[model samples]
Target chain A: MATVTILGKELAVDADGNLANLSDWNEDIAREMAAQDGIPNLTSQHWAILNYMRKVFEKEGSAPSIRRLTKESGVDTKTLYQLFPKGPAKRAAKIAGLPKPVGCI
Target chain B: MPSETEFQPIQKVSIVISKGSLDGVYPGLIMANGARMEGIEASLFFTFFGLDAILKKRMDNLKVATVGNPGMHMPTLLGALPGMSAFATKMMKKEIEKIDIPPVGEFLTMIHDSGAELYACRATVDMYHLKREDFTPELDGIISVGQFYEKAAGGQIIFT
Candidate 1:
């Protein structure tokens, strides 16, 4: 496992992979997650979503389908929308701390 | 210039276009469009009344909300009067169109063409009793909340 200090907090990086070199956006996300009491404090609901998203990416090398996310998390569609006001892909990618998906703006 | 390999790849992005006001719609569209230009895979999930922008009939008639939003900075209360939101929406739309950016309809099409997904909340659809036919053909599909999360799992999420 690798560890990095962001916004005065040390975050443990999973052995799956490491994020590319820190960028402004990366730092910003790290700060935002840190403000939420480090990623460890994230609710199981969020963790479940993020972890599954990562797994999907690792397996498919592509974005996962929304229908699949709903089935996997057992969270309602409306609740997921409420959780990610922008949309699921954007929010999940950010929280999962993966690079932006291909074909976005 | 940063070569493709030199630049970092975007893993995910989620954008929420929640405002029913016309002016509010542009920001979400702009951001979503911008993200697409950057080569990031993105999705625009319309919920609540925001679904108006995607509805074939109502999309062209969307209006801005000028009253009671603390987030909006208006030069004058009159600027946001009843009809002003609509006018403002038009002006904003014109400006964006002038830049060669596609109109809302076309922009949504581009997003879909680029492989970006669009979803309408099933609950909202049910609450409003909106029929699938009411939406434009571009809609990827209707989805439940849990399904939305499954897609949103691994990337950046934004609430516009």
Candidate 2:
């Protein structure tokens, strides 16, 4: 376990840096996490991905995979790489305040 | 010269599998999927009996290996009964599907779309008389073990 401070409040994070508690998530926290992940600014594209992941996680209890991101999340693979730089699935999920995706490398 | 801190990170993982049953194939798929999930390049090499899982016609029909298995709770005699393999496969499939995970076919599509490279063993293809058309459309290509080795060179290789 690890901890990341967001807006002066510390929250638990997983070994891979994903939020351990979904309750600790919010848009501002998302922005802070995204910045920590190397994206100092969050664009609409990043929000779109974050929103989609959080929405799916709310119902499914897990974030969607990169495959689902490209297929159903209205984002394409090339653009996803451009947005997240590297390891889009892990990075995006982390920024969205979700746990590392199940079975992720 | 590359900076000490800028040396290349591990970029790829090669998984070699020689078992073809449902149980055998899913671990390889999960590992490859897991690798891609972490932004690593993942390649699955199917050889020998493992070729059964990637065969277009048989990929979706893979059955569990229940015979002489110690891990499964059932007695070895019960493992030989008709429908046991299918029953076990169905049970496993249903369990994984509840979490929104796709079936074997769709799982392949997801991993492929996520950038995991799929490959078939050339010798296995030839030995089985399987045509290139017999594998899923996502297969990068069939290659010999030597070629696979060349591609997998330094990162990591796991035999499943």
Candidate 3:
């Protein structure tokens, strides 16, 4: 486990740097986490991906793979990488307070 | 007893795939895709028969080497029976799809879209007289072994 201070509140994160508690996540925290990751601004495109990941996680109990994200998130693979940067599925899931996706494709 | 500074994390990987069977090809594809998912640079060089993985006509129809593979757990003679390879391939494809892994064509697209470089070996392409149009559009280019070595520099090189 690890801790990150976001919005002046200390929060626990998992070993993979994902939020420990889904409820600990909010728009402010997502923005803070994104900023901490060097995405200084979260565009609506970014929110779309994050929101889609959260919705899928809520339903599926895990984050969607990159293929699913690209196919269903209304985001292409290139733009996903641009929005979340290297490892789009993993990073987007982290920012969305979802577990790391377990699928290989 | 090496110093910690000598143990830097793997930043890149160059994989050379020289076999064309479904079993032979998927390992390299999986490794390359896995590397990209880790934010590490990945490049795949398809040589010899492995070029089939990139060749549009053959990529989707790859079969498992049922006869020679000891892992098949059957007699080699029985493995040589016609339709055995097809049956095994069908079963494997089912298992692969059950796990949500895409077919070779779609998998290549996903890997390419994720920014990993895919290359077909120039020497083999020349030997086989394969034209550029014969390969998938996802291919970055046809490159020589020298070029492969150059790209592989400073990274771990894996042959599958």
Candidate 4:
């Protein structure tokens, strides 16, 4: 486990850096987390992916894999990588307050 | 002695896909895709029968190797029966689809779109009398084994 401080609050994170409590996630927290990870500007496109991830996690109890995101999230694989940088699936899940997706794609 | 805290993750990988069977080709693709998901640079080299994976005409029609595959739990004689390979391939395809794994063509496109470089072997291409137009447009190039090694230099090489 690890801890991150954002918005004057200390939040616990998993070993993979996702928020410990799903309820702790908010636009501010996500922005701060993204900034900490070197993405200082969060565009609407970024928000679109983040929201889509959260919606799927809410319904499916896990984050969508890269393939699913590409097929269903209105974002192509290349753009997803551009939005989230390296490891789009993992990084986007982290920002979206979800656990690391399982299995290799 | 110095402290041994210099552990590092793999920076890059070059995977060789050498078989054409559906089962044989997937391991390399899965690994290459996983490598890119980890921020590691990845490249794939297709040779011999593996060239079928990139060949536009045959990419989607790869079959499970029923013959001589002990893992199928069937006797070799039964495995050789007509249409056995096709049946096994259909079953495998269903299972793969159930798990959301795409068909070979789509999967290869996904991997390529995700930034992994793909290549076909020059020797195999010539041996099979294949042309550039025969391969998927996503292919980066067809190169010799020496060129493959040159591109794969300074990275882990995996033959699957």
User: Which candidate leads in DockQ?
Assistant: 4
For B1-160, candidate 4 gives per-residue lDDT tens digits of 7554566778899999999999999889989999988878999999999999999999999999888888899999999999999999999999988877889999999999889999999999999899999999999999999999999999999999
Indicate whether candidate 1 or candidate 3 has the larger lDDT: 3
lDDT (Cα, tens digit) per residue for candidate 2, span B104-129: 77788777766777789998888878
Model 4 C-alpha lDDT per residue in residues A8-80, reported as the tens digit of each score:
9999988777888999999998998899888999999899899998999899887877888877888898888
TM-score per candidate, chains pooled:
0.54, 0.78, 0.94, 0.96
lDDT of 3 at B73: 94
Candidate 3: docking tier:
medium
Q: What CAPRI grade goes to candidate 2? A: acceptable
Tens-digit lDDT track for model 3 on B1-160? Answer: 9976698778999999999999999999999988888788999999999999999999999999889899989899999999999999999999988876789999998888878999999999999999999999999999988999999999999999
DockQ score of each predicted structure, in the order shown? 0.05, 0.37, 0.65, 0.77
| Model 4, TM vs. native | 0.96
On lDDT, the leading prediction is 4
Best by TM-score: 4
Q: What is the lDDT of residue B116 in candidate 1?
A: 73
**Per-residue alpha-carbon lDDT of candidate 1 for residues B58-135, written as tens digits (9 for 90 to 100):** 887776565665545675677656677777677777875565555677667656654578988888989998999999
- In model 3, which residue pairs have backbone atoms overlapping below 3 Å? none
lDDT of 2 by residue, A1-105 (tens): 688778999899887777899899989998887877789999888888989989999998877766667778788766787788668877888888888777442
